[model samples]
Target: MRVFFSTLALCLTASFAQAQCGGSFSGFVNGLKDEAASRGHDRQSVDQFFGSVRQDPKVIAADRRQGVFQLPFTDFARRLISSGRINTGKSKARQYDAVFDRIEREFGVSRGVLLAFWAFETDYGSFQGDFNTLNALVTLSHDCRRPELFRPQIFAALKLFENGDFDPRRTTGAWAGEIGMVQMLPQDILDNGVDGDGDGHVSLKTSAPDALMSGGKMLQHLGWRAGEPWLQEVSVPDNLDWSQTGLRTTKPAAEWAAKGVTPRHGQIAGTLPASLILPQGRKGPAFLAYPNFRVYFEWNQSFTYVLTAAYFANRLEGGPVFDAGNPEQGLSGEQMKRLQQKLSQRGYDVGEIDGILGAGTRAAVQDVQQQLGLPADAWPTPALLNAL
Candidate 1:
């Protein structure tokens, strides 16, 4: 009888979870609470953690409207890497000089890199975000569209709550459930969080040292190489093979130098394999993306954002402002979506026809350009679309 009852209970719980995934919002949250109890969390704590987690429709709206990523690289970078942001980053670097020094020594991550993320993520902790974190996480978890990506985060947040580090009702952050100054997700905090201020508690939201150091540790955990360059501005010769541009193709720095890919300022790692990325096109700002640049993708998957952050880090390290050349105008959002559809029809995996020039879309554009005898700079144009 005991064995039969246990089997029946398991089947019922499984069915309940399945129903919750796409059913009413209240049912979904109940499923989460039940699952927490099953996972060894005490019922009282689980109830406390989720008692007030109202679903945030605004988070769902923000998740669906990531249209800002469609902006051209020059415009995006220019908007993000403002002079004031740079000045503030430099000031923070000085203010937290000792913390940064310790971070570099312990984690093998750069201060410039951490400072750029700090400035960009929350403007040196001036604003971490305003959304109720528990609500956002619960909402996103209940959302069927990418539930797998967000569902686990709710449990991680619960662990923080259990530790007295999180307040379900009061803890606020980004709409995506990222908490603290660097905008880290809950799992990141659980896995890589550091208490840099020597204060037994890891106060990432209120302590600059904790935030910066924790950010550094997270980067290191993401496979950041010690003291190695991530991005370098470069001058690609007019005669250089445009087909070899884009991150899909990598060549030794020396091979690129032999082809007249000169560094605009700092020394290039001679033997290190690097990809030549023309963010706008061959005519626009060019950069050599080093091995460390790949790790930025682990932080944020958007190619444009990772590039801008890396470039800003370089600027913080005293690199010159990029010379934005006059590249041809790219496709509008709808046009780009149409282009993606065409590419998909042609058997190229452009990920989604969302109108964003993501890495997959760019790669598809490059392949089509090369096939059609175009410049193959990976910057989609109306000409290419018309040709398709």
Candidate 2:
């Protein structure tokens, strides 16, 4: 849910034909005033600003779009790192080289990763969404769907108003409450965004310099390491506990090489530790993902989302493909559930037998595969099902 943008815009102000929410909104303003006062913030302006809020159901539905329910890895990756994005990234690589270089030098982060984020967030400032941030957030907070998570963000948005991050009158973003060219959440914008242009203010929407540097600063804050590949194609070693290694902890490059793994580019930064992972399945590209790469995953939990960002970063850097070979058919949702149940029955301790294949389930599947003396791919297949 990292990349969700938390864009749950329950537009409390959109002119939908729903029941009149003016009373409810007025109550909310009263509550916000009390809350702000309790928090040592000025209550007058906060009340005035929140005086005219309403619920936007359209935003809620949009946030819950089925496209995100079970997006295929291949398709998600394609949508993110498209040809247009790559081309633009290349141009930006040159256009903003000075800024990027300075950022990279200061932060020890990769320009490509930072630029990829900027590109993915708002198409390098091409089209920031036109939704009203305050309206959307206020609506989401009132709605019970994610009130706890969103309510705090709404408060943070108010703080932004208090501190003058942007003019509340014209600040806009995605349907949810993300703003600017990089689509920063208000909370993150407050905490991480830096004034890169030195213009005495930071605005991600109108300042490419500020947006890019803020993005880079975020990666730095997230623990990016310089002179290290975010991720790299690697040969999965024989008998390696591939499942446990994935996104759990990284192993030293030499240890992986000792287990028959080898960097595809032979530029093994040998000093860094990497987590071995098989994205889709066996016979697919194997990657030893670095910590910074894992940080990208922190931003977007989807493997495909992070992979696309990293892959696009590489594309921007003129890096080669990480294709391992022929990939296998990924497990469908039902199949994944079945696999989880089977693993649980065999005593793997998957949290629940629900079809959601998470880290625990994948690790358990690997354990089952190892015990069964399979190819050790850790993939759920008909044959593996037959074993049960």
Candidate 3:
């Protein structure tokens, strides 16, 4: 009787677990169907789209485990702009020289810059992701964390299907619904997709020319300057004021020159409106980011990503590597979390306590550094943590 009761309890637990999974996902899908239909999507199309869509726990897990934002700029940039990646980018550039020339002539964006974005986004299309686009988008839309952002993407995916641009059965991409060689979102595809190969259909996934041209078009639409340097590596003087070393403060090249900042390689003649960005802090490396650098922010909001993409583009053009001034080690995730908590306790709004030192957190750190009469580099250091 005891064994029979134990077996009965195990069976009940399994049945309950199965029921919970099926019921919760089914309800979420029904709600998504209603929402999509209300947003002017065809009811039949919405039903067909959501009918076979299963809840992807893997997508949710991937979203929660995004660690790239937590890494220091030096580490992140070094990994992405390695010697191997630079060689591959150059090879791709030479392989598609004619296509890039045409794209550059039409869009006025650099071929190397486009190649950098492609390499960074999906490793030159070698691994564009394998998650089903529809399932991923629908699952993300059902999630409560950022439903507003993902819902529109789901509608965009549906519209792509309606317009005969995407076949749902073969459409696979990143976990967040980004598709194609350059990992463009659904709305981006609809807005900036171009038929570079001129086959009458803009298939960015299979056509290299189409993806490259579409990326160029997207950058052009994002206000990429015709002929402007994105950023230049520079050496900052030791006696320079530490307060003037962030993206928030813009000064002319003449002003920086007056303060003893010089380009590492070339010359800074004109008074271009540029900002001094110390990526890893005052001790790491300094860069004079020009107006065109903002275009990279539009491509990706992460400062590390934008800087790495720009740096990689420059490397492809035979630019020199960064000056080695960064520290041997940076803060770990737990240390960063502790620093953020301390900042919050002192009334500095560091945004989330997620250990990722973003703009808000950096600004708060700068404030603390200023209060403590230290160099306001805005970078979290072990000494800074101890001071806090």
Candidate 4:
């Protein structure tokens, strides 16, 4: 009996050792190696790629701690689309007029819009992040939170390596695996990359024209309509119906004009379809978002971010600043989380308890404001949290 018990303990110890080894980071990478091989990637190359990768905790932390969605449009825009950035974009448009002219002629995407993307993505190529592309993508793929999204990106990166478009040792980018001056992901690099500089290779990191042309091609593929406005700042009358002040409702310019909505600068043609966006509620700036605005959302999901890009693009083209009054500051992350919790407790579907206040949270805030006889502008404030 003693011998049998000793043998059983030894077996259990071996089993635990095996489990620990299989659960290690190296083990996870090995599994990816096999998966890549099955997907027809060269085995030697896969091994070479995996050998150089180290899991990046900083990348994982950044993915989990994004707070940009919580910032108010005014604060976000003011920080990103400053006068310096606008002037730089304008100068770049002229400095690279030959390149921009060619890209626009080919892709039908405006130079200002492409420059806005460049400025926003990496400060006009001044900084394009420092994380290793392979490390970030592999680590993100191993994480279970969104494996489906990042796994394909890993394969796409591997394909880029195979095609000589990326070097695992030298390919560094955003924590989320976006590369180059315009901050495109590996999948986008494979799909929309263009050889703009006549180098016979699409090198977005080293070549400005390549990045710009690739970005322009992407925008064109994403349905950017030539000669269409993305959005314009506008004034909303106090007597206008508050229920129709969000992206969910759309109306012709004539209908909005009849309801006392007009451009802050000049009259808009009545034939255009537009939706009102009160980024800061009725008290702050408003915008009339046109159909071309959807293409901006396709580039970046944050309404505030897309709006900033569009506004910066317009500024690059010599447009005026918003005539609407400056927006009040938005809630901090802690305040936003508290508001989301309160809304959830009150039977509003604010989705996750994460601090980012997205469309669902905004809608819930609007419902609460309506119930409490408040202004119902859907904008969260300290007072709104206190009232709840």
Candidate 5:
């Protein structure tokens, strides 16, 4: 009877998901329009908001092709941070010196962090993407993968439309429906948008000052400490405990110091809490991630991407390049999937077995390594897979 009920529950869940996700596209759109009107949005405004909305297959394609995220931190960071991008970031910082200064003063967000994001997201507004904003949002909302997250943004976009800020026929941006220079969603703009140029409108796309200030405000809203460091490159002793590494474990800076964790440069706060992150394992580059570093995850969830962006922010502030030490090669996508399967079978919740070395998978690997008396460095290897 228990097995029968579980099967029935599974069937019900599949049916419910189908009802919410894979139905008629026109009906899904019409339901959205009805919701807007019900929420007291003007009929004309609602009609105009979704007028040109059409499913963009390209957006869906872009969403699925995020395989670049599967790459190791070293390779991914190398692809993103370049001398040319760094130079351009410096130039932009100087050009908008006054704006950045004001942003730092008002929002307590440093120019280096915002500049790194601006450089990476749209290359200093060189390309903010060319997809239709409304189409992208509506299409993603109608799709099954992440409707709950995207559906509300459609309404937020409508609010922007009502305020004369967004255009369904135009307003191109990232395929994820984020707009303007820093690539923010409509909801984020509504909540944290700023008029840094004093133009009475929060125009993030065309206005550099507005984008920088708005991005700064958003970071502050995401729990950025007023005057604290985020990422700092550090050196760890060879005999340091491997299980103590990873983001899950944190110790006071003094405690880490006691463990022979030395800053590659300046001193870390003695009392401040920090996590020793061995992104490519203990053999590779290491960083002491502070409280402010957690905010980067709120910005972007990819572990490697967040680390790279934070490190780039440090670089913009004159931080030195990292030393890429020799590390063992990690498991490929298939091997990772197999490892995740084994971990899950042993009662570890490794989130989707998508073959990405995410935090969950890393934690599970560390636990299994400890059990097998192996180095719990959190870097998956072929030997670990064989042991499993």
Candidate 6:
């Protein structure tokens, strides 16, 4: 109720923004008319459609909030792995083993990553959000902060309506107007929604298969590699170029071996390019990642998220817990960046030497630590800096 009232108030204030320009309703009706003529839609239905879409401010605010988010990786990981999410992920993973296996086999993306996303985005679709997508986008588009960015989405929603794809009054979605189970935005619905229930129409909402498959398709489109693990737990030796094993770029397994780094499991079986990643200061789990890990990066660029996702996936696979007992001392963001900068000066690329300790920076730090004959946890410290 609060959301609805807030939306109404925003529209009342902003009515002048559009009502003055021959009115929002008139413009909407006109656009529908063009769409109707193009697709042979009747005039009355078009008018009805135009009347149905109202501006939604709550959703706009929601989108605005999500757009500028920055949470530390550790914090993000802990939040996603809440007890509720873990149990839910486990249950869903077992229940959908067939679908997951097929998707895994075909896409090379593990079911755990898929499941984790489902858990995160909408809590296994329980909190898919509630809002009228068209209204929100249309309202936001007219809000003036960035109309050019949202106007097309509103238009797209209208196109969907005018085409009889979904009734405007009945179609609802997330606060930012993400539809159906996967909470896909309107553009994604247009491009990737599928008729998972054997219905002629494709929808992101109301169909579990449709939503999950749409998400899977997005993963595949994002460069998911088949037949490769996203990550692997590795034994970072007491001394090695551990930092160079970052996903910022590639290094061959043999190159890593030359630095005295060995996998906890054994020597890597092939010449696959891998990156070193240490998520928890030097005291925590270290990972060897393949190209597929980059795919996880594509979905959401958080070293913490990808690492935890991989760990959760490992749990799903019955893999052992990380043998590294504790996190090495953590580096402050400033100290970490300086460490990264030093590594870059020494010919290791840690990606911009940013204060953020992303996988690239960690790998660069590892390389320096190994060269210095220090334990290569990739968690740089003042002591390490003092030696430099």
* Alpha-carbon lDDT of model 2: 0.70
Q: What is the C-alpha lDDT of each candidate?
A: 0.85, 0.70, 0.79, 0.79, 0.86, 0.62
Clashes of 5: 0
Q: Model 4: residues >4 Å from true position, as ranges? A: 1-22, 266-269, 324-330
Global Cα lDDT for candidate 3: 0.79
- Rank the candidate models, highest lDDT first: 5, 1, 3, 4, 2, 6
Per-prediction CA RMSD (Å): 7.0, 5.8, 10.0, 10.2, 6.3, 8.5
List clash counts for every candidate, in order: 0, 8, 0, 0, 0, 17
| Tens-digit lDDT track of model 2 for 62-170 | 6665344244455566666677888888898899889989888888888888778788777888888877777787776666555554666677788888777855557
Cα-lDDT of candidate 5 = 0.86
Candidate 2 residue pairs in backbone clash: 7-176, 10-56, 11-55, 11-56, 12-54, 12-55, 12-56, 13-54
Worst 10 residues of 3 by lDDT: 1-10
lDDT of 4 by residue, 209-249 (tens): 99999999888887877766777878888877776777777
Tens digit of per-residue lDDT, candidate 6, span 48-148: 77676776657666755531113344555565666677777789877777777666665566777777667766778787666776676666655665444
- Over 334-383, each residue of candidate 5 has an lDDT whose tens digit, in order, gives 88899999999999999888888889999999999999999899999899
In model 5, residue pairs whose N, Cα or C atoms come closer than 3 Å (at least 3 residues apart or on different chains), thus clashing, are: none
Q: What digit string (tens of lDDT, one per residue) describes model 1 on residues 152-263?
A: 7788899999988899999998888888998888778888889898888888899888888888888888788997899999998889888899888999998999999999
- Per-residue error for 168 in candidate 3, Å, reads 2.6
37 in model 4: Cα distance from truth in Å? 1.2
Model 3 ranges with Cα > 4 A deviation = 1-23, 326-329
Q: Candidate 2, 253: how far from true, in Å?
A: 0.7
Local distance difference test, candidate 4: 0.79
For model 5, the stretches where C-alpha displacement exceeds 4 angstroms are 1-19
